[model samples]
Target: MRKYSIIFIFIAFVCHFVTGQNKQLLYDFSEIPQSLLINPGTETDFQWYSGVPILSGISLQAGSSGISVNDLFANDGIDFNDKVRDRLINGMSPKDDLSGTYQIELINIGYRGAETDNFYSFGIYNEGDAIGYWFKDYAKLGFEGNADNLNNRFNLSHLKTRGEILNVFHFGVTKEIDNKLTFGVRGKLYSGIIDFTSTKNKGYFVTTEGQNNLLSNTLSADLELKSSGIITLDHVIDGDSSAGDMIKRGFFGGDLGLGVDLGFTYHLNEQTLITGSLLDLGFLYHSTDVLSYTLKGNATVEGVEIILPDAINDPNTDFWQDLVDDVEGLVPFEENRKSYITFRPTKLYGSLRYNFGETVQSKGRLDCDCNLSGGKSNRTKYANGVGGQLYVINRPRGPQAALSAFYQRRFGNIMAVKTTYTIDKYSFSNVGLGLNLQAGPINMYFMADNLLAYRNIAASNYASFQLGINIISWGKN
Candidate 1:
């Protein structure tokens, strides 16, 4: 009976081996930015003058300058989770029950200056940036009962994930010719870290003695006993056991790029103006560290014992060990992997506005404005979507009652923020309040999209944020 159980167990293992296929390598390039499309002009006091670049200005300005910093962080973290889920789920192992999450933290500081005299404007600046993401996953499986007769069956699995991080540094200059014709260029430095791991386990059992009793009890029992022998044959001999495997890898990379921003602002009338710009035309490169892993496992069989060789049992064996040992190893140790980071081409922006009742009284005059912008990016395998925003703002000549209203459309990983407001009897003229904050030569702000974490799917809720600073040549006063 034990012998038969062992045979059955071996067969099951072989079947498991032959039928299992590597999980499809789901590569989610969603993080890849959409084309740089026309985006609404939104800047904060600190950002507008600070001369720093922004990922998306309109949305960040909508959050109200100086809202709880915690809120800004919370919104961004939630949005990242939502955007990454679509890619994470596909890469998950079938045997793994995954559960783990990660969040990103960013900090940026820099200076920028721009010099503009009628026809030409040139600028220069430097910035420092840092960001991170973390997540964890736990995967497991278990089985109980006699290995030979298969009296009972049970299974359990779980996955937990943490976070990963990346950092960036940039220093460059931009140039613009005439208020009507503008050109710019910049250089960037990239650095980051990625660490991921997965683990799995399986358990089962078999029976041997019960078959002998069945054969003696009834005529039909003999036939059952014969079948039992074939099943319990392996289990009766090997006994209960457990096995598991895990792999982990870590790497880093860098990138660089050059872009141009051509914008034109024309006066429609004494109280109105229109402006637009084509932004972000450049390329970036990244280099990642070589990754390696060690694997080890143990399992118990019922009928016959199958032992792994000592070499295979050692978990200390590095993944690169084999390649290093190769007789004619030209590449001693894999140094790194290179990739081109292409800028999404959808960053184009345009806007129309009418300003009325200029500041004539001690309390500044009121200004009302509305604006919209949208963009999209396409990669080798997937296409990113687009979004737009509309907003209005009202401010007293002084710092007193500054109010605004906004509405935005965020699809996939994109986000928009629109606003509107009313003040004093004289309804202010066009005043779209899409501005970033600037302190001295530094500009910084935060943004988010896809507020909810939805995996393997695109939702209007996905969000993202950017806080940046740059130095530009301010037009001669």
Candidate 2:
């Protein structure tokens, strides 16, 4: 079990097998239209809508909290390198993490804006994300090899992380500032088809007490690794480009960014309601095909002062290239293509609903399908409602939250349903389900989330799903 202890047990088993904006069944499930992508001031009486482009929408999510993978390579034989050195000397830390997300929607549409209480939307989507953690002193100095932890110290600032894959073009607007507030906003344009990052790492790695190698090691560093639109391990071993020109240069020449999203919904009375949102708030801007790597220097060592080469007609005795050119002359390694900046992993949502049975009123055409006088409309809803929500995100071992409780139903103008129950940090038996269907102007929906791990999804830590389809219109108000 050595090769840098199998690369630190493959990075602590890829940080518990690299795996949620807690969009509990599409948040307020307002007869699903992607629930206005999570509250675009919800409340749409639809006058137009469309989606069905790339099959409308789709989403996926995965999760990990603490650990999994059959609780670490389950073979039950025990001793997988002493359970990875006793789970790196007693089960992980540094806030144990691993996160995930994904989304797709090639184009979505909406309308009804010529001031009729306004509404409008636009879309294009693609997303992928990740988060990481568990850098407990580099897995306890790679499973105890700082020559017996001489002076302790091992930290390189718990090494942070970042990940991405993107493309998004958006537009939105929602307004209705009278009978109890409503507002929405959105704007985005990003297209950064791939990225990798590592943020703020600093020094440490110790061992001391030497003199003819009893022990003496040091390596203070400041690391960095950033990338964008990857591809270049010397162009993947010289195959010189083709993968549809790296997918048309990662979906149209990578690297670009900008973003925004904001929302609201209020009404303190008339059956209570309140909402909130904030998403992406973004950035990205890794200059085209960029790559960077750095490892600032500081070094010391006691053994291996270069001396080897026994019997082998030595062609200039290259003893492991003179101990890697004497550790690159005291720890130096840098590579650059520069240009970097990434952000966008921002999320937050809020909710509170209450609206009870009975109160459906939109048989709008007020006055027997009026055509000559007396017209007024816009007041329809209430087959049931009940809610609670709160989700937060922004992590690197900070700010993560979730809490949910829901129940919604509607059966008069098509069909609708929503159900939920959540408690974050990965499972309290998640639950969640949603469905919406409308027949006349078409519109479809489906949702899922940790439904009791679908009865044992290998001891599920988390799961999610979403689906969509649309074409809607309504207004005789």
Candidate 3:
């Protein structure tokens, strides 16, 4: 039973994060109020905007690199066991990951500061992100008892995972330096609700021929799992805790941290613009309700070597127990209450767009709407724009990047449409579409990614969508 503990933990850890934080559809989508969340420097034409409370902004993205549900449970006639054996235990690699991210805005509102001529934006939102790398070697060792395969070292380092849920309160000031440059900076306060990580584990287990016994099992293991706010969350789940307390924990009654975001937009020429933003460049400090599991050191056991006075034929189980106890002492599993710091998964977004076609008339005005200051110039709003965008996020394995090219079209001042084709590690043929509509002072926008995969979502690797509604004032007479 002691020998099975290592592999059991690995099998459990492989179970789960999803589509990541690549919001290509909403990166530079100035039509939606939430685009500011991704790029605070996003050019805003509205004089002021207020989201529709909790219903204002919502986003979710989920995906896996190695296998989809259809691979195992498709209607095809392959045997279920065989599919699992081939697709899961055999075909998957260490780099393959299942990860996801989600966000819900609670309060989003912005206004133009009259004194400084700067746009001020602030909001609070709940976010959760998780990622887990597939444990290939451990799955193989568990599925196929390592009796036949000698000298094959099953890596303990294949286990890498992290997850967190927190709320962020942020305020930003976007300033247009000149007609050619616009920049913004946002400060963030993080209230962590729950978090866990087991990303930097290292070691291995190998079975080799022994001189005194038929086999020698050796394990070189260094592993640790750190968690914060899990105890309270567990209590809440078991009905032993109040929901209000949990919400309080999510609102700075628990752990706390700080972060900042920076973004900028630069117009190289009248028809060209370069834009980018860096998000979540900060860390969380967790001290309360922290629990950690650690398994370190090394141990080796050659079968169950035991000797008794009754003779070798009838061995005392206590002697075997003694051997197990000795081995366990050499490599102990421990529980600890220690503080930790977890860095937020940082993301980068950049794009270069070309504006063209006819210049649209300003809302209710063919001439300049107001005085030209704060980077508001006589520059025209083109009816068509084309661009390519790049999105990258720091992952446990490495930085993953996606590239997309889009075409945007505007219909007068009432509606806008954008279509994109993106290529990433998950899919090469992912396509996205977005729409922004305006009816008087009401603003609504929707963006969907991997639209082609909608035909059979289960077969696709990644898909996501974002939508929001807000009231806006352009300050036009």
Candidate 4:
């Protein structure tokens, strides 16, 4: 029975490693919307029409909270039923209700050419999180008269995850040929630490005579128990540990991209001007670590009764190694195994903006803008999604300061108020709703990722924020 359990663990681990490389399939539903956030051209109209020299600004943006994988797995509570456990343990078909959270932060700063109003910008972005967990159950087969029904039951719990703390530094320049055409190119250098952990927990159990009598007989009879049959098996082996120690090694990689923007004002409109740009053409190199394990079980026939042990493997020394080899067929072990995963970041976007009351307004002006964007990866296993943002900007100046009001929508659902105040070279932008607020420079902004602490108040309740800045010295011409 113990050997059988070891074999099962080994197979499960292999399957996990293979499937993780296909993250696009697992995360296909969470793709970023290109129009709303990635493409700068989509929202270019919001920028000042009379371009300022040294268009240097820093913008920092981040989410409100982080989520854990355990939260998702424990959402509905643990199910002991055999059928349900099997479906979860084995790679079942994809389902939508898989719950988790994702958060990202970006900071950018750049310079706009005074002569040609050509611009060069640079920025850094970091994203990370704990996604979710999955649970599965396995049963041992015993011959008739075998008394140890306990050792025959093994429950396996596993977690599927990938996370990275990455810093992407990018340099881009745009050349404006005329009011109608602009060309741009960008180069990015990515460096960061990636940590991936995969774990499997195996527990052995024996059926007790009182409430678990059914489980006892089921295992002793060597019957092919259905999924629900293991619900009452008494737990014997509590084997929980973390595998795949190679995650400590972090690697580096890079990519390149180009973009363009166009603006125009019709002759019919001395008062109206239309503007838009094509944004984002880039790719990222992702380095990942692969970890594997296996669990197996063995059984022997006795008299009319069945006897199962309380423990599955020896706790003293090489038990884990022995168990793994028994199931995996003696493969060579290496401390460092690496694979590179690659994908295009997302596509650029274009938008049109119409300005009103150019004749009536001198310093203060009103503009209405709509932008659309979408992201599709070269890898089909990855997810795809679209997004849009609509906003009205009102610019007015006071004796000591300049003020602008904005309403922006994101992810097709979330909406917020954006306000900016400028005092000379420094501009502060603030966006938020309810308890969360983000405030910072034109190029950089700070935000509290989550306002409502879901579970642990001390850790989850507090507001987490980020800061960013952009510095561009030349490139207007």
Best by lDDT: 3
Give per-residue CA lDDT, model 1, range 82-165, as digits (tens). Answer: 433433432333332211112222322322234321122122222211111111121111211233323332221122111122
Give the count of colliding residue pairs in each prediction. 115, 0, 8, 67
**lDDT of residue 77 for candidate 4:** 57
Worst 10 residues of 1 by lDDT: 19-28
Judge candidate 3 at residue 400 and give its lDDT: 90
Q: Which stretches of candidate 3 lie over 4 Å from their true place?
A: 1-19, 306-318, 364-376
> Of 3 and 4, which scores higher on TM-score?
3
Error of 3 at 385 (Å): 1.1
After TM-score superposition, what is the CA distance of residue 11 in candidate 2 from its true location, in Å? 21
Give the alpha carbon lDDT tens digit for every residue of 1-477 in model 4.
874475345333322221101011011011111111232222121122211222211122211112223333444555644433343334332111121222233544444445434555555444332222332223122212235545444333322332333345555555544433344455655443333333323333334443323433212111110111011111212232122111122124221222222222111122222333322233334333223233334322221222245233433445456545543342222233343332322222222223232121111111212111111100111011212222211111111112222222222112122222111111132222211111221222233323343344333311233222222121221
User: lDDT of all predictions, in order shown?
Assistant: 0.25, 0.73, 0.84, 0.27
The per-residue C-alpha lDDT of model 1 at residue 119 equals 21
Residues 1-477 of candidate 3 have per-residue lDDT tens digits of 432353234323323432257888888877777888889898777678899998788888877888988999899999999999999989899999887877889999998788444789999999888888888888989999789779999999999988888899999988877777889999999999878889999999999998689889989999999988777866765678987877998888999999999999888887899999999999999987998999998988887665455556765457677787887788889999989999999999999999889887666212353323324554567889999999999988889999999999999879999999999888898899999999998988888989998899888888788888899887764
Give the winner by lDDT: 1 or 4. Answer: 4
Model 1: lDDT to the true structure: 0.25
- Candidate 3 matches the true fold with a TM-score of 0.92
**TM-score of structure candidate 1:** 0.29
Give residue 214's lDDT in candidate 4 (0 to 100): 42
**What is the RMSD of candidate 2?**
16.5
The candidate that achieves the highest TM-score relative to the unseen native structure: 3
TM-score for all models, in order of appearance: 0.29, 0.38, 0.92, 0.37
lDDT of 4 at 51: 14
